[model samples]
Target chain A: MRRPGPLALTCCDPLAAVTNATARIILICSGKGGVGKTTLTANLGIALAQLGQRTVVLDADFGLRNLDLLLGLENRIIYTAQELLAGSCRLEQALVKHKQQPNLALMPAGNPRMLEWLTPEDMRTVANLVAERADYVLIDCPAGVEQGFKNAAAACHEAIVITTPEMSAVRDADRVIGLLNSQGIQPIQLVLNRVRPRMVANQEMMSVADVTDLLALPLLGLVVEDEQVIVSTNRGEPLTLNGNGSPAARAYHNVARRLRGEQVPLHDPTRERRGLRARLLNKLGMAGN
Target chain B: MALFEFLQRLLGRQKPSGTLAKERLQLVLAHDRSDLNPELLEQMRREILEVVQKYVEIDLEEGDVSLETEDRVTALVANLPIKRARPAALTAPSD
Candidate 1:
């Protein structure tokens, strides 16, 4: 539930000062499928909420919506974006607040049938309504540059393009960046996901430099490949929810902090790979080795 | 086998597959960004040759046009072999 307060009065808290301004509407997208777009969205949503900023994650991928499932709010959803837009329910009625994180809310977009009738204007209308109450509105965009993508991008002022280091993913991301540019979206950023450090060190997989040099976008963060991500996803809990100290979880937290105008340094893969052995030795009190 | 592999590495006789992947991605992205396929590039070469031949004689078979990408910027590079300049009378207007 949303609490009412003065819209213009500035607060002593810096986080509140940011929330006083209009919500930042950002779209998370990737032109290719199964490249961790949804995963990034769910994790980032939780990370932002943990930072004490009121956040709303809208699942704009109507054809194959899963943000709710990833957030473990599927069973709690009684009304969706469809009902809100149809005037059967209010925005508060459609929004499902997280059980663990009350600061975060999830708005599941209408089902696949709504794909036939929903337009870009309708998306904007819903986004506008959601923005009135949130400090940040993250739209989980669908894959590919189709109508769904357009509807998702239509309401966003900024974009975060997520991609793996593979050739196909990078090529598709480049295309999606071109589309976002044409739409006049500003300050687009990139996230490199599922990076295997050892493979990169052995020159078997694409290095961070290789992908960044070609994409030509400021990298927001790097998420190392971790098996715990699969385990967390199957349990319908995002990596950022629990303080597991997983590489991907830390990366998500760093990304959220950076988004709030903090200066967190990016992760280096080679150093992280070497640090594992050193950390193990330190834990065993064998630092001299 | 390990010694032989070490020797090959020391002598720089082996190429890493990452280098190959980077090279291939550069070539393909150049084409993809410029929206120019091999057939289109050939057409462009022929048109460029026709325009250049109006002022100078060029070898039609030896002319080539291709895309090159560096620092994320793509350029259309052409190499046209010149046989000789056209005669003044042919190049100049009749008036």
Candidate 2:
């Protein structure tokens, strides 16, 4: 006993707290609504799952939980997060399994009235559970700078702001990034969603480079306004599962791979449609349709 | 026939998809951020016009100010000219 005196304290010491650990929590937020935050979150979760990461999406929009409907898991919700918070249910009891994807699951938000009492500490506690249980946690945030926004943004380690090329979306995104920075979250990534190519070809819209230049954040993903998106969302399924050969699907997959620290190519597939006409037309001063 | 021609002009198919999306998205996002709705923007514009008229001889309705967003920043931008005040007369004008 006297010889083993020093080993007593070292071997049985408790590990560091999880909140202090470097867990990866990615939050998808947007200042404006109807810019496809739910759709993006669903596809991204599926894409991450496809990359072999056990991903769990937490729909932080308590009152309006469209992530489940978008993912076609509305009917699978057994126990909401409020039940777990109230001690009436356990953590695993709240999870809704994905239809066919075994690795993917969702922890849907609580009742509309129940979420009214959920504090920031509660969200962090939920994140702690997700960090312990899954490889990655993607939180879908509510739009605008309100109570819901604050609640969803509470436990995030990093953020991915979704925006369109329009000046208004970019401007709101700038304000949201400023708010995130003030909250000690810096270097947020930007996902330029609903980018239309024909407009850029005709000099009618902002380009990806233009949007990024304005936002000046890391480009996590650039998704086109594909017809498949509307179709998949209508069918209450994710676009990532809609035939991997599609451009939007490939973009989502590439986004997931990039998130996994892979050196995925960031080719602007729409670039070919630009300037080729000019090159064929004897090198005009500017390219236009 | 005139109404049909005006409708054709208003809903012209020649507009590029990017242009239309950008235009619609700009209007929506401006309202989305700053919590300033379309009605509020109109009211603000009217109030601003009234306030500016008291200070400057703005052609009551000529000058325009609007809330615009650029790259995630919202700003109240105005197109009014910065006019200087007229020099005061040395003495009162004769009747």
Candidate 3:
């Protein structure tokens, strides 16, 4: 059903020679929905690409796949992993390379109707094939600890569990971490998302400490709630793409750097908010004098 | 009332919502992670009481069995008040 063309493997050949190290197949997952799993996947992919890592983001959330839309590659998807697995298209044909960042490519999952036909073995096959050419394969896992999550976990060597500071999110993250542990996914890390520094300062919301204490995972990065994230999502452009220096964008970049074994310090939202307030107070005092 | 409230806020005497959240989460997660619901815990308490009653005179009303999580490790902590040792248990041969 597919043409055995030499052209399929030609595009990704340069990266294989660039790095001898095997690609890190990481799963980006959260047990609860609306906690920014896809958002993290999109931004992290762009960040890793900017760091010169040839990255392929595999959208494993077939039932409610929107990773293509988030990365702004929705219209360019001609073939998907389903077609590639079915031998209807080549790997290069199915991969939708980012127009802005050529280092990054997206393999969007097929329609929800095909969800029933997909299995964990199919996911591993796709991940292994993509891993052959890239330095990173990020599987955007679906919400919940269901079959979709199992399929995604089957393909990853490690995982990044994203969660908000809310009670429900943290509880769900703990459960997901337990599941990841049972799956033998080593060195699992946590990324606390949508942190509101002012709220935390006022004791209105959970602090990063409270979350980390409960989840008991190594803190990978902290993304303070930035309005720019929503704007960039609507534009289908990840915040890291513009290098806008937004809080969330910086956090994402730091995550990528840390993944590269760089010892970048995690962001402290509480201290950041206090620093901003102190600077404003000093300026106001000077103006009054 | 308003002045008192302002003074309380200025002195930070009021319990913050974040602390409440943390306390609540600790209690709930201990149960959630242990996979031991309240009903199951109650059943366990009854069964434990039945087993212990045969060897000791215990205060069932004051007995407590609950899951506690510390350092990411959940433990089933039970405190059963033993009123007295039964004559049979006291007279049983030493192992």
The top-ranked prediction according to TM-score is: 3
Per-candidate TM-score against the hidden true structure: 0.84, 0.70, 0.86
Which residue segments of model 3 deviate by more than 4 Å?
Answer: A1-21, A272-289, B1-14, B53-61, B81-88, B93-95
Order candidates by TM-score, high to low. Answer: 3, 1, 2
Per-residue lDDT for A1-289 in model 3, tens only? 1222322454456643433248999999999999999999999999999999999999999999999999999999999988877767777789899999999999989888777877888888788777866999999999999899999999899999999989899988988988998889998999999998886765557888888888888899999999998999899999999999898999999999998999998769686564342344335442111
lDDT of 1 by residue, A129-162 (tens): 6786799999999999999999999989899999
Residue B16 CA displacement from its true place in model 3, Å: 2.2
The whole-model lDDT of each prediction reads 0.82, 0.73, 0.85
For model 3, the local distance difference test gives 0.85
Residue-level lDDT tens digits of model 2 in A82-142:
7666656555678787877767889899888866587777777677665655788999998
Two-way lDDT contest, 2 vs 3, winner: 3
Q: Highest DockQ among the candidates is held by which one?
A: 3
Q: What DockQ do you compute for every candidate structure? A: 0.30, 0.18, 0.38
Query: Which 10 consecutive positions of candidate 2 chain A have the poorest summed lDDT?
Result: A1-10
The reply for model 1, stretches above 4 Å from the true place, is: A1-21, A271-289, B1-14, B56-63, B70-73, B81-95
- Model 2 preserves the real interface contacts to a fraction of 0.35
Clashing pairs in 1: none
